[model samples]
Target chain A: MNIVVCLKQILDPLAPAREFRVDNEKKEAVRGAASLVTNIFCENAIETALQTKEKLGAAKITALTFGAADAEDSLRKALAMKADAATHVMNDGATNPDPLAVAQVLTAAIQKLGAFDLVLTGRESGDWGVGQTGALLAELLNTPYVGFVDSIESADGKLKLKRQTDNGFELVEATPPLVVSITNDEHNVPRIPKTRDVMMSVRTPITKFTLEDLGVDVATIRAGGDYYAVADLSIPVKDVQCEFVTGDSLEQKVEQLAQRILEVTRAL
Target chain B: MNNVIICLFASAGFDRATQGVAGAGRRLADALGGQLHAIMLGAFTATDEAALAAIADHVSVATELADYQPETCLAALTQLCQPLAPRAVLLSNDTYSQELAPRLAFRLGGSAVADGVELISHSEHLQVKRAVYGGKAVATIALKRNPAVVWLRARAFEPAAPRDVTANVEPAALTLTTNSATRIVERKSESAGEARLEDAQIIVSGGRGLGGPEPFEDLKALAATINAQVAASRAACDAGWCPPTWQVGQTGKKVAPGLYLAVAISGASQHLAGMSDSKVVAAINTDADAPIFKHCRFGIVEDYKKVVPLLREKLAAARQ
Candidate 1:
């Protein structure tokens, strides 16, 4: 089995809110002192791929990413986790491309890489949180798509998946040459790579491709009006002033809080 | 007339979220001076039909789509939309629509945006405001294609008011080919009867400071007293103190209830992202300096252990 996982490098989502800043002119987040890390969902995807490979025993897993040079670090982490190979599609144009452009670029890279039985991606990136890339990529790739899958197992030459739904879960079966977007589950938490594997991952050879190499036009993607454009980006100002319920005793405070809760619920 | 098509999931059965999307579509259609068209997928109740008829100028029901088969639904929608040439396609942000919006947009040669909290309609285009960077910031995007496809966050818009006049209803003209390569083998549903976090008007959420899983039971008791749903912060859920399904954060479920009562949570940005849309926020925490105080409408600086039980008792007594 041939499995390919798509990874993304994004600003650490856990960073303090005070430190987050956006450049309105550029319609992008100001990176500033924030550090970059692998998107947690992508790490979950990598973990899912690794576990799938482990179950199949003979499957080869490849990690792929489309980002600046710094994204190599995410690929390295995936390699340390036991992926067989890695590919980097260098994105030199817009720092953040819309989902359609991303799907187009990823489709080009995947086609250039030849045949694959399955393609996996994080359900959504931590940054924009658009949650559309995997579905769009499936459309562009002309493959069957599944979203919010947490686990995959091989079943009689097919893949069995545990898909998360709003209500609960569904057990699904899909043929090979499928696209799936993985959501995080306790079973798929990304494992930490060993120190030896980390060092070896740094030494591993990674294939690199440019947009031109994939026959994708950077200008077309960078053109603002073709698909969608960020008209404005700003922090919404919330003017909520908290009224603290004060009391000398805990019971008094609880009484006051209950009274306030009743007031609010009654208004609702 | 330029029509705005609102897609309703019959599986969801005209819930508030569906009604909210219909309201959003009605607003867009009014802004465009166009007709509101509702396309109901799957089997719908009579209440669903009446409600859709009251809000929309026209209603189309595709009963053949009784279940959510992505490929089949996509084909049916694509076929239904080609002749309508709508100004925009609206859907509620749910698992099915989240999966369908982008694919439908791709098929229709349009652009798709998800989780929109605000929609701005211009004479020739539309703009969407959505949260990004874990809800610390908002981005307003302008769509550049025709029939802008978008899914709106729940509770962002009011549910459509039923008008006195009924709309024309007819079966949709669609040719569905179910050549899906994927099939569901089985389904496991969570036990019903408990109030869902999204639909609850009041939510009582706990976080890392609650110490352990035992405290969540106290929180649940308090929630039960008020008929609210119990949720947990990402920190609590990550520690396995509660089910991940009960997690409310940027990566988890986004809930915008009438009142959000937080306990022991320090209010991380990701956590704030999920509940920032809440109408009223109240917190009970030992740390007065916790960031949650900044966004809350009411706050109490005390240990939740002492406050929760007493508060629950007071609320129960008041109800009685």
Candidate 2:
């Protein structure tokens, strides 16, 4: 069995999230990058893949992603997590798509690769949480997909999925050659790479694919700017400082904090 | 006075903390001397028959969904609202409600406000108060009149409890159609944080400054220590430091917590626009001139690096 995961290298938010050029038309903070380190959702995807592979005992897990050259760092991280192989698509393409385009590109990539038993993606991207990619990808693949997933257990050649839906929780089961998006938050945190394993990940052989290689037109990809928008982004000009209420001493500070809480909540 | 319509996610099985809104809408309608109509779609969840009806003057349910589809749900709501011509169409901002709200107003060609908190000054320009700037400040929004529609973030308001002796069950018979473009073929669940941000009493948010995903550990530690939930600004989520589900801004989640703490965040107007209405906001930033300071009742002009760790330590020590 073969499982494929879709990922994108984003700007690390910790670095100078602010970068501007003479051409102001393109001044987005580092494209939501810092989230690359086994993001909660991605880790869940990897975990799901690993679990399914374990169930099959001889299954293979492949990491697939597209992004800047630095995105290779994330690919290496995936290798450290014990994925059988990795694929990085580094080329000029839409940094963000209308989710549909993303699905299309991912679908095209899947077709290019040999058929797989399962295709996995994070329930939602760290940057844009439309929860669209997985659903759209599944729609394009004409396969079944599950979302808001916290855990997965396999048996009898069937994968059982649990969903954290709007109201609460529900469960679904599906066969192989299906699409499953992993959910994240608190339930399942991604495992950190050990120092020894981390060093070895960089040495793993990684396959590189481009839009041309995938036999897909880059024009078909939608620009991130068009799919959604950040209309007015700016720092507020106002300044509202703390109104200290005589918390001169430690005990006094606690008391004053309590008093302020009352004032803020209008309990006073 | 105008008629009231409490558009519910009863079909979606009630989302987030929509129970609060259902309860609150009943109270608001009672206060305004209007008929409180509880619109339950799909099947009823509440076991007590009388308890459900006490909140509203009347109860309506739509069922046999054919299947759970968004377009089908929206079309059902449009048909329901067309004949009623309600003064305000209230909705809960769930995964489906968020999509349903704008379309409901659009299908009716009426103006609507999403993520509304309180119906402040509803005469003429039905103004509402919402949280913004990471729950630091509150802003007033005036809804365009006639048939005003509003979508409140989940848990924004409390559901009305039934005050009457019993609920009068009225089943709605309607042919609901759906768009074939989408379907829910699979769903899976993962272990999640303590409480959904919308339901938490305390929220801790991080901005672009935390540096990386690992630092979220510190924030998460602080939240665990204080029994608080974690949230993030659009900038942080946009930069990939955090997931969009945790984002707090105009384009993200709107939270009105009892206490909102923002670390390393330079309060961008867009981020603040979604959280400004938080009851008490505390901002910790290195930049004293950061816009977040203006809305905070407690400003710690120090590096979040030192502040977050120290805060975690202090909170832990105090708890111990």
Clashes (backbone N, CA, C under 3 Å), per candidate, total 0, 58
- Model 2, residue B161: C-alpha shift (Å): 17
**TM-score for all predictions?**
0.97, 0.58
Kindly list the per-residue Cα lDDT of model 1 for residues B132-214, writing each as its tens digit.
88888999988888779999888778887788989988998888899658887787767355544666688999999998999
Model 2 stretches astray by more than 4 angstroms:
A14-24, A30-38, A165-170, A185-188, A193-205, A212-217, A220-232, A235-238, A248-252, B1-8, B11-40, B43-60, B65-254, B258-279, B282-295, B299-320
Docking class of 1: medium
Q: Quote the TM-score that chain A achieves in each candidate.
A: 0.97, 0.78
Fnat for the candidates in order: 0.81, 0.14
Output the lDDT of residue B63, model 1: 91
Q: Output the lDDT of residue A220, model 1.
A: 78
**lDDT for each residue of candidate 1 in A1-268, tens digit (9 for 90 to 100):** 8888999999998888888889988899988888999999999999999999889988888899999999999999999998999999988888888778888888899999989999999998878898988998899899989899999999898899998877678888899798999998889999999999999999999999998889876787655226677889998888999999988888888888999999999898
Task: Give candidate 2's chain B TM-score.
Answer: 0.80
